[model samples]
Structure formats: C-alpha cells, structure tokens
Target: ISLLQDEHELARIVADMPWSKIDVNGLREQETRIRRQIERIENDPELGQLQTELKQLNQQATAENRNQYQAEDDLDKAQHAVQAEQAWLDAYGNDDFDDATLSSMVSNLLADAYENCFGASVRAQDRPKLIAGLFDHESETPFHTRALRNIVRIARTRIQEIDARSNQLRADTERIMDDYLNNHSTDDNTVMASVEDYRYFLDELDELNMLVTRAATDEEYANSVKKLYMSFQQLNRALRTDEENIKEQLNRINSMLKGQQFGPQGGRLSLDVTFSPIDRQFETTLSRILSKLEDWTRNASDNPTETRNAFNNCETFVNRLHNELDKIHDTNGIKAYGARNLDPRVRSSFYAIVHHDNAPDERISSTGGKSGGALQELTSFVYGAALIYLLGGDLTARPTYTTLFLDEALIKADGRYTKRALAVLPRLGFQIIVSAPESKTAEILNVANRAYVAYKDPSTDNSYLQELDSETITQDETQPTTAPAKPTTEA
Candidate 1:
C-alpha cells in the first residue's frame, strides 16, 4: 500500500512536471508503463508481490541503464524541460487561455511537439473516468452517442414510477410542440423556445422518471433526480411523433441514399423538396460511399492497367461524394453535432438555479394585457434549472433550492405545503427561510448554521432598513452538535 501510494503520487508529480526541459522521449514509454503496472498491482494481488520482486530488478536495470545513457541524453533533458514548464504553468494559473495572452501561452505550452507534450493533467482521482470518457467520446458525436447510450440504461432503471399523470403531461407537451408548434403554427414569435426545447425536456423526463421508479441506492442522487424531474415538468414539450428519433434519422438517411437520382449537370443528385423529414438519408449515403472508396485499392487487381483505372474511378467517386456532403446545408445554417455546449454564463461556480421560479409558462408576449404571471414564474424556473445544471446535478432535478426566502408565499402556503417543502429542502440540501408574522423562519433558523434579521428603525428621524447578522447558537450544552454545511466546490 505504501509503495503503491508513493508511486501514484510520484506519477502525478512526474505527469505534472514540465516536459520542455526534459527533452528525452526514450524513457516516456517506461514511465507510462510503470504507472500502469502500479495501478494493475491493486487489481492483481499476485502482480503486487511481483512488483516487490521487480523493485530490486528495476534498481539494477537503472544502474545498467546509465551505461547506454549517453551524454546530453534526451530523456534527462525532457525531465528538466517538463519541470521548468511546470513552474511556468504554475506562475500562469496553469491556463493562460485568454485572447491577448493565449496564443503566446499556447505556443509556449505546445513547444515540445516532438514529445507530444500536452499541458493537461489527469489527476490521480480523475484518471479512470477521464480515460473512459475520452474513449466513449472518441468519435465526432462527442458526448451525444455516450449520452444516448446512457439515456437508455438510465431510463430502464427508472421506468416504473412514470405514472399516468406524468406520462399524460409529457404526451401533452410533446403534442403541442410537434404537430401544433405549441398550438401556434401561424405565429412564430408567439412561441418562446422551439421544438428542440420539448425534445430536450422529454429526454430529461424520461431519464428522471426511470430513476424515480427504483429506490435510489444513494439518497443524494435520488433527491437530485426528483428535483430535476419536477423542474423538467416546467419545460416545453415537443411531444415526439414516435419514440425513436435515432431510428427516424437512420431511416431517412437510408431512404435518401436510395433516392440519389443521377443524371443532369455533372450528375447532380437534386434533393426532393419533400425531403424535409428525411434529411439524414443524404448524409448517411455520402458517408457510406466515402467509407467503401477507402477499400477500393485493397481488392485483388484484375490486370495492373485495369486495376489502376478502377482505383482512379473509385477515387473520383469518393471525392465527388465528399464534395456533395460538404454542400449539404440546413436552412438555419445548422450542422450535424452532438449536444455538449458548455456556455459559461449559463453556469456559476456551485449554484444551478432553476428557471425564475414558476411552473412552465408558455406565454408569447409581454405586451399582451392578459398575459399570465406563469411565464414569468416559468422563466425563473428555467433559470433555476440552469442553476441546477451549473451546480452539477441533472437539469431535470433540483439541487439545494430549499434555501428559499419565501417572504409572502409562506403566509399563503399552509402547514402541509410548508411541511412538504421543508421536507424536500433537507433532501435536496437546502435551507429555508420564511418571513412570517409567526416564528416559522425563526423556528427553522434555530436548526440552521447562521441566520439574519432586517428591520427599519423608525424611531430615528431618518428611517433606514438595516440587517442584523445572526448566528445559530446551541441551546443545549450536553448534546453533540452537527457540523454546518460548507459551500460546495466546483467539479
């Protein structure tokens, strides 16, 4: 255990060490293999014992290693370069990624291209998932395929609790978003977010509903899922025509591939005007053609001359298909992509607040006199969901929103309302405060870490509202006290 810990720690330090000064590439493989062997030592106990035997062997190898190690060795220089670069990155917060200074920093960071020096670090804690995510997200789809794969597993896990009410709500939302476009096909601006909104919400609902079906082994995870599901209820639903969007895309692509009508100027395959829904067909066909062309030369040659001609034809076909795929465009200039947008403004360090604080409000106009308060509330709710996402929970679930200052709402929400709300806060990791004439806020504050009260001093000539900071103190000296919650750190 001691050797393993020390080696792992050394690996981290070496991995972080700047490579600019350590110019040798020869020892790189050895260094990496050593780390991998150490990790496997834990998995294979026999290997652990072997490592002890190998320990002495490695020292002997090192002694003989210097015999082959010539003066000004590359590995020795690389080690020094890596250490120097580490100090440089440390001086620059490890990421001088801003515009004005970014290029200079990046050029310096990537100076050792021969060594394939990457400034990134895979900290010991994140090594496993970091490697796995890299492998899962290897292709062009980025995280989408991985997400899609995960969505199924997650949905199946929570399939049971998707009760009739939830299903109906989802179905209704889907229908309004799809066939009707929020029941306002004639009016575009009348709708706020589009069909995409509904699809994403439905996806979230499906994921959470499944989670709710089973008894979540982790309480925190369960609460997070529930919070997300409740928040998802506030989103626009595009109700899908069917449950298989991926299948639909594939079918359309296959259909378009079959429909490739060849004949006119340079044999251009004109797209059918009615091909609105089946656009994926064109893309899939081109991709397939490109893929087949790569193997054209691998086939046995009929005659050398005949084979050369065939290869040329195949190359021409591949090039044309590539050009056609490049020409393909969406009306909105959209392109095929996975959904892993990481807009910083939409997130904060540790808080992901759901929309402004209402149920889904689908109102179109602020100018309309009859416009409801629901939209405003829904907007707040969306912001709240963004907050949840920002805070590292599923967007469909709520995080620590229980730290609510329900000044007026508490008076209206009776005991049961307050009870359920209070119950949820602790589960979701929230603290609640209600400004009621009764001591509701005070009551909860007693169990809280810290609290404050504000009042207007009317006795003075000029009245000003001032807040008096308050701290929670123990009433019992003999009882063991719970530790206060600390502010969360970003993942």
Candidate 2:
C-alpha cells in the first residue's frame, strides 16, 4: 500500500510539473508533408524524371563552366596588360625611363597581338615612323606610346564584352535550374497518369535538389534542423506541464469524493417535493372549514345531523392531518426541520406549529404550511432518491429494498389519482406498501405484487388471515363488490 501511494504521489508530482507549449499544428503539417512526399515518390514518377533532366543539365553546365573559365582567363590576361600600361603612364610623369626599356615593354605588350594593335594605337601619319623605330628598337616616337595606350583600352573593352557574355550564360542557366527546383519543392503538382507526363515532376525535383544544395552551402539546412529540435523540446515541456495540471485536478476531485468539510457545517441533505391535485384540494377544503368555523362558533346549530356533519368534517380533516404529518415525516420535511434545528417530533403534531406572539390585530403566522398528505410523501420519496444520487450510493452500494409503508394513506383518492401517485414509486426506486380500506383495494390490487384480506369467521368466532390471489381479486373487482369496512394489508 505504501509503495502504491508513493507511486501515486510521484505520478501526481509529475503531472503537476509546469511544461511548455508546443506547435501541434506545425508538427501535424510537417507530418502531412512528409507523408505526401513519400506517397509522391512511391506512386508518382516525377522526381525520377526530374533527376534525369538534372543529370543532363549537369553535363551541359560542366561544358559551359569550362568555356566560362577560358573566357575568364582571357579577361584576366587583358586586364593585366591594361594595368601594366596605366602603371607605366603614371610613372612616366614622375620619372623618365630610357628608350630601350620603354621599347622593350611595348614590344612585350604587343607581342601576341596582330598588326591591328599598332595600327589602332598610332596615327596613320606616325604609323610608319613608329613601326621603323620599333624595328630598329627605337622609342623616340610619342605617337607610338599613345597608340599603345589606345590598343590597351580596346583590349580591355573587348575582354569586358566576353566576360559579360559568359556571365549572362551562367546566370541564365542558374536561373533555369533555380526555377525548376523551386517549383518542385514549393509548388504542389497534380499526380499524372502517364510516365511521359511526369517530365514536369522531374523538372521540379531537379530544381528542388539545386535548392537543397544552396541551402546546404549557406547553413540554412542546419538552422531548420535546430528549429525542429527546439520545437520538440517545447512540446516535451508542455507535456510535463499539462500532466502536472491534470494531477492537481485529480487530487482536488479525489478530495471532494472523500467529502471535504466546509465551515462548521457538518453535511448537506437533499430534498425532493412532489405536489399533487389532492393536496391542493385538501388545502382549499381546510381553508373553507376555517372560514366557516368562525360563523359556526358565533351561532352553534342544534340540529344533530348538522353536528354529525361537523364531526365527520372534523374527522376527515384530522385523518388528512395524520396523513400529511406522516408524509412530512417520511419525506424531506424531517430533514428540513433538522436543518433549521427544529424538533421534528414537536413540529409533526399540528398542521403547522403556529407562533402566537403577535396581537389579534396582527396577522397569524406559522413555521410550516398545510401542504401535506400525498404531496409531502411523494416529495419526501423524491428527496430520498435525490439524496441517494447525490451521495453516489446508487453507484457504490445500492439499497436492498427501497420500500415505504403508508398506513391508511390516500383513502379519498380516486382510482386514477391513486394509480398515478403509485406509478412514480417504482421510478424513484420505492415499493410503497399502503394499508387502505377495501374501497381502495381495487386500485391497490391493480398495482400491488400481492395482497391480503382479513376476515372474522362467524362459526369459529375467530379472526383469520387469507392470502388473496390476483385472479380472484380481478374477478371480484369487475363485479363491483362492496368493500369491507376494515383496511386491507398491502405490500
């Protein structure tokens, strides 16, 4: 038991832990994307086709790269010559170089060029002199020096054009590859039926691969991996927090189940009240009797029949009073009295325990009301059933017998009213056993499991009990036999 309790406590502690929030939607979307990717690869041929195209493009790009390299080499060589001439020009203004050294540099600059270099650089008039000087290894002509600078400028411009062309070609190819790969990775394509139609998919795959390569080089892929790892950590933190909250809630619920004491109050009791038409009628009748009682008291009648009627009326009222009080005792009335710290035994006597502290001019008041009888009984039964539910006794340990004994109850009730009142008993888990005169026997027999009729034997001069069978009762009820004066036992 100790081990179990410790484990439970540990679980609660774990559950109570504060955790982090997770991007559940993001995780779901990622899962869906992966699933779709797998499905596309297994069922579609787009990726493979893109790979083939990418392979072909790779070969073509390789050749193009070689050409670009050559062009770059040429551009480098041209730029070097321009730099050499510019350097010489700048230095010429600062320090004078000998003609032989200048002539040697110019010869070296124009060594690989055609005659166009000399023709373009020097003027037509100075061209012959510059050429003769160069042949004789002379640097006397200033026109030759100017012509050499012009040739260098021309070479630089030509190299720039070559470089631009090479760059443009490379840019176009890279753009095509990037577009293809991006479309494949980011754009959703419909699955095609034909393998031939899968070429578009291959184009996308190629673009995607290229994109991957770029991301890999830039550490973008690593960033994504780190982001995913952090997301998982957050999810775990959230899980821990949620578990702790759940455990705390469970503990609270368990405490409630164990019945927590709130305030100095001990416990609460439930009550159910069911009012009936008979109870209403009784209330009206009692009101009428009270109204007439004052007039009767003022001038008492000498007539015996009137006196008998009064006594019978009083007897009827008293009988109803007993039933009402019994109803209160059986139902929530006792519980209500207990709640108010009133004595149930003392309160059960009168229709309602009245307080007479006020003067005659003041209105009379009572602690309770006259709404009793079947109404109170029904109410109490309902309250009892509700109490059972509130206590969860029905779920834990059901009562063996939910029975109520009402002696001489509802005697004035009609067959319809009686059955209706009885109908609710079973639903409320009540088996009401009512002792009533045989006039109400038919109604009882209709609903009762078994009934007994008591009769005094004339020959033996002894009282005997006989178990009345259901079939005999049914037959006798149809014929409308007079009810016996004595009340019958019902179960």
Candidate 3:
C-alpha cells in the first residue's frame, strides 16, 4: 500500500510538470535531414576527387617534386616582379595634392616668408615655385633652381632678422603684461588669476582657429568649435554670481516693501517676498544672462553697443523680485473670527486673512459671522473706494469723476452700519447712487447728491425712473417712499 501511495505521488508530480507541445512531423523531418547529410558525407564529391588526385600525384611526385624548389623560386620572383610593378603603378596614380591646394599652401608659406623678409610684403611670381622646390627637391626643374636658391638665401637672412625681432617683441610683451598686472591687480590674487585666464583664453583661441581651419569636413570643424565653446564655458561657471546677486536684490526689495511706513490710513498693506532656491535651478541660465549684461556694460562705450544693459539688468532684477513677491500671500497672526460658521468655501479662502482695527487678524471666513459680516461689508466698501482712488487721481490733490453705483446698499445691515457706510463713502470722494428698500432710502439720501427711484408704472405696465430731491425724501416720514400716493381729501 505504501508503494502504491508513493507511485501515486510520483504520478501527481509528473502530471504537474511543465510541458510544451511537440511537432512529430518536424522531428521526423530533422531525422531525414540527418540521414541525408550522413549519406552525402559518405559519398563526398571533393573527397572522391582528392582521393583520385592523391594516387596520380603519388605516381608523379618524385619527378615533379625534384623541380619544385626551382619552380617555387621562379614563381616567387615573378610574384615579386608583379608586386613591384603594381606598387609603382599605385605610387604614380592620380595626384592626391591638387594644383589649387598646392598653390594656396605655397602662397600662405610665401606670404609668411615674405613677411619675415620685410616688415610687410607683397606676393612674387616665383613664390609658389620656391616653396614647391623646398618640399620636393628631387623634381626641382632647372628653371626654378635659380629662383629657389635666391628664395632660400633671402629666407635665411629674413629668418635671422625675424627671430631677433620676435625675441625683442616677446620681451616687450612680457614687460608690458607684468606692468599691467602689477599696476591693476598686484595685491588681488583673484584679479591676477582672471588676467591669467584671459591670457590662456587668447592662446586657446589661436589653437581653436588652427584646429577648425585644418579640419577636413564641416562636421569636424563644428565639433572642434563645440569643444572650444564647452571649454570656455568652464571659465563662466567659475565667474558666475547670478544666484547670489538675484537673492541679494530680492532681499533688498522685500526689506524695502516690508519696512515702508505709510501715513495714518495705509491699513498695514505691506508686500512680503519669499524665494524658493530650488525653483531657481535655472541659475546657470540666469548666470549666463547676467554675465552677458556685465560684459556689455564694460565694453559698451568702446564697442558701439547699447549702454542700457544696466537698465535691463535692473529691470530683470525687479521683475524677478516681483515674481517672488507674487508667489507669497500675506497671513497675519490675528484672531480667527466666525470660527463656528467655518464652511468649505470659507475654509478655502483661509489662504489669506485680513486684519483691521476692529477685526484684527481675523480669518476671511469670519466675514460670514455676526461682527465679521459688518467688517466684511466695510472691507468691500474700502476695496471699492481703493479701486476708485487708483483709477482716478489722488482724491485730495485733484478731483476726479469718482462715482459709485451700488445695488442694494448695505444688504442685510442694520441702521447704524448703513449710516456709517453712507457717511464714510462721500468723504473718500465717492458720489454714491444707491438702490435699496424704502427703509434704507432715508439713510442713503442723507449723503446722496441726486437720488432717483426706479419703479414699474401700474397703469402702463412699463418701468419708469423719476428723480427725487433730498427735501422731498426727508419730508415723507424719516424713511423715503418709491412714489407718493394720491391725496384722499374727499374720503
């Protein structure tokens, strides 16, 4: 029974084993291929031919082998001769150096040679031949030999003179450079190092020119230029202070805006700026811009470039400061009014809170509460007045058409708040036209210049407006009426 149980377990394992489908016909085809390959090997054509040739070669081996050394020697000699002829043909094939290129090279060499011979020079007819002779004396034509010798003689004399002048010039340049460095940057290691860097830049620029000119293709030239650009950029990285400058400028502006003291009614409106350095990962780009501005500012007068780079830099700094200030929203550490009535809409508005004398440091959500409501209304009134002040000129200095059309004045406010709003608006240079219920009409008319009542005429079923004088409004009970009713004298 145990053996049966073990067999059953083995059967289960086999059943669970991963298996793949097999093609029976494909296996049969592979077998047939193997059989055919075996048969072909047994009757190989090349093997049969080699076997036949082996027998024939063995019979003739002694005779042929006796002359094999001599035959190989002759064959080697013939092969060598063929190789020599091919090499000669290849050596004399179409010239890689074209006439135009040769002439241009010779002209450049002759120009230098002439420059060395004289302080400044002109090209000669024999210059190209003279240079070609120096390179290829084996092919020196009899006609050019005299000119070549004369050129060599002249070059020898000129080279000595040029070497002497070059030594003197080098000494003078070294003296001048030393004097400038000592005078301008003797104590400043940083400035001296920068001067050294400028010298290295000039040296590298000459090398870059050589590299680009010698490059065989446009692609090669472009790559060389890119490499030089990258090398120059390394110096830029060392000299950059854009991030620090920007930070300093922003901090200064923020201090000014924050510390600015306003007169009695400025309402503590101070702008605060905060910077996230991480967001300024584009410091490299900013550095390049600032670097260009610095360069332009330095050479602008001499180079006929615009001198407004200073102004541009100032503008950029101010704009960046503005952006940083914009990112920040002011929050005051005052009381959170209307705490009980904090709704979702009110909660979202908690991003910024207002503080005034009455509701100092109160959450904007407080606007929906009892005392908060009055403050909120007052805030709205002040905000509208501010808009008018901004749109118009200064109220005290110059008069403007400062008119406010208010619909439903002091909505849901009591008499005291209504009366206060009416009193404050006019003093702020606002002529308010208020449309409200008959109850608040009396309060609105107290400060209004000309009051008008809009009503629907019952008989005509059309809306019509009629102006009302303050006396007429005041004569009708303390509150005003939309329209006066007819007198019922007979009744």
Off by over 4 Å in 2: 1-377, 383-397, 458-461, 474-491
lDDT of candidate 2 over 1-491, digit per residue (tens): 99999999978876776655455588799999999999978776787888889999999999999999999997985566566556655756478546565556456545544366565556775544443343333555454566577778866776798889978876776666667666674455454333344578787876677686843332333333334334434533543354445445334323322331111122221211221122356556565665444344445444444444444455565565556555433354443232111122322221211122232222213324433343533344334444445443544543556767878767766675566566555544566777887677888788877788777665566776778896866765576357544433333
Clash count for each candidate, listed in order shown: 54, 15, 1
lDDT of 1 by residue, 1-491 (tens): 99999999988988988987565676788889999988887789797789988998999889878766854485675565566546544754466455565566444433333122112564554433332343243355533344455555544444545566577777776666666554555665544344447556676776787678765333334344334333323211211222244334333422322322121111211111111232355345434443433343245232444334434444543454355455444667775422111111111122111221233323232324522333333232333333434453542345544455655444443343344334433433445554555345543444444444443344443433323233222322334558543232110
TM-score of 2: 0.23
- List residue ranges in candidate 3 displaced over 4 A: 1-376, 380-382, 393-396, 462-491
Instruction: State the displacement of the C-alpha of residue 273, model 1, in Å, after optimal TM-score superposition.
Output: 24
**N/CA/C clash count, model 2:** 15
Model 2 lDDT at residue 267: 27
By TM-score, the better pick of 1 and 3 is 3
lDDT, candidate 1, residue 102? 53
What local lDDT score does residue 433 receive in model 2, on the 0 to 100 scale? 73
- Model 3: per-residue Cα lDDT over 1-491, one tens digit each: 99999999978877776656455588799999999999998799998899899999897997788689789987885666566546545755556745475656556666665455422342564343333332244655642455456568766776788899988877776677678778875565643333336677676777787777754443444443334335435534533444445445434323322322222233322222233232243354456555655565356533322443333444554454356445444469653332211111222222122334543553434335455336634554445444544564544332366777777757676665666556555655567667787666666666566777666656676776667775755665564466667322110
lDDT ranking from best candidate downward: 2, 3, 1
lDDT of each: 0.43, 0.53, 0.53
Model 3 scores a TM of 0.28
